[model samples]
Target: MKDKINELLERVENFRPKAVAEIEDFRVRILGRKGELTALMEEFKSVAPELKREFGQKLNELKRRAQERVAALRAEAEQAAGEASSQIADMSRPGSEEELGSRHPISLVRNQIVEVFARLGYTVADGPEIEDDWHVFSALNFPPEHPARDMQDTFFIGKNPDVLLRTHTSSIQVRTMERQQPPIRVICPGRVFRNEAISYRAHCIFHQIEGLYIDEGVSFADMKQSILYFAKEIFGEETTIRMRPSYFPFTEPSAEVDVSCNLCGGKGCNVCKGTGWLEIMGCGMVDPNVLEACGIDSKRYSGFAFGMGVERIAMLKYGVRDLRLYFENDVRFLRQFESAL
Candidate 1:
């Protein structure tokens, strides 16, 4: 029995498992209910009383050594299994899936707006973001001394009056006029630049879609009907618009269009500032001077022009409280519109 104990101890000290299954087998052989340790413990009672102490200690030592050997074998086997797992893993298998991206909320809204107008026979016209004063302001009937042309309000280029960042998409309207004659019906959408401090309510850089409709005899009434139809189409059929007198350089007797707040349902709310209305856009009959400046026969061909801040329209449509949020590329905020897409 003593020789058997020493031999088993030597074997345990030298034992090494190459796999997890071998370690499991070793555990069951030494530690399971019917294992070698249990068999030795059952034989402990048969030893002589005088030698019982020594034999008992030997049995305990054997058990301890067996446990240690099993633990060490398990650790080695686990490490081996890990290395083997990495080597044997199916490298040909497809990698983990990557998340897909979606259209931005602002982009989705812009497309919707353009699509709505497109359905009404409007063709899209684009122009340069960096434009000259003649195309941006002067041709659009902006006075030479207008504050918009000031360096403090406009982004001037090379200290020249003829060159500057376009302050509005209406600049595209002027460009379209110079390029196309009467019977021109088009929508201009582009980025506009202004020299204003960024804030929750306003941005120095924003987007606008200005609409121009020119023919033989366009009037304020035609403009009104068109705006109303657009309002109904965009804001739902329940929408109502109120046009308040306003002013713009290119439009005579210009008006600001306000739609009944969808959020408050015309009962007044925080979004509408208790006014039950949200200003959507500014519009007016194209001043004859503007038409004449673009070389159109002002008397024979009267037209109307309307311009709206795309951000403003998006804000009103979606109840976006902060203008800065649209510019911030926060994934969480944009993900809210996932369903909106």
Candidate 2:
């Protein structure tokens, strides 16, 4: 019994495991129900009473040593595994990671809008979010008396009245017109800012996509047909549209564009406020004055301009009641869009 105890103690003190399989076998051999230490304990239990205490003590020592050896073996095995894993890991190999994102509702709508217009041969155009007055309001035909220049509507960077944050993507249209000649076909998409109280429906900042097309003899009929086609593509083939006469400072004979409410199928709903039509955009013929202001001859150049709010379109499409939700960055709300497709 003493010999066994001494043997196990030496084995435990010198214990080392080179691999996981060896550690597992060591654990079973030491701690298993039918292990050698357990058999020794059984033998000790049956020993004559005179030698019971000494033999039992030796058996317990052997059991303790065996347990310690098994623990050391396990730790050594794990250490070896870690070292080998580090050596064999392919640092140059392409990494595989989780696919954890989906397009945001706003991005989805924006891409869809771009795609629809792309099919119609309009190229995507971009400009700086921070822009100047000449391109934004001046070329777009804002009158000198227009209140938008009063510093209440625009965010100015430098003291110069020329440099300011763009309140509309109309600035991009102006830039495009100044650079590109006739047969101009471009869609400008960008961020716009306004000073407003954040509310369920309104925000101080938002996104807008504006389309401009200039060529010979572009008419209100052409504008209407283009909008109708856009409405059909966006809403559905069955969707109907109605143009409500409206006014804008830039475009002559401006009208608000609306689509038949999909939620109620034009029957009227809370979304449409019982009108059965949800206003989507505002558009009109490019004013002759605006054309002249942008260096395009009004006599030779006739075009149409249309603009829509991205968040508004997204809200109507997704039924997201609160505009604040778009900016909150709440994971719970964002995760709902995880499977956007």
In order, the Cα lDDT scores of the candidates are: 0.85, 0.85
Per-residue lDDT of candidate 2, residues 58-139 (tens digit): 7777777777777776777678779988888988898779868877778888998988999889999999988888887888
Best by TM-score: 2
Residue 4 accuracy (lDDT) in model 2: 68
Q: Give the TM-score of candidate 2.
A: 0.72
- TM-scores vs. true structure, each candidate: 0.71, 0.72
The true-structure Cα RMSD of candidate 2 reads: 9.7
Which stretch of 10 consecutive residues in model 2 shows the poorest summed lDDT?
A: 11-20
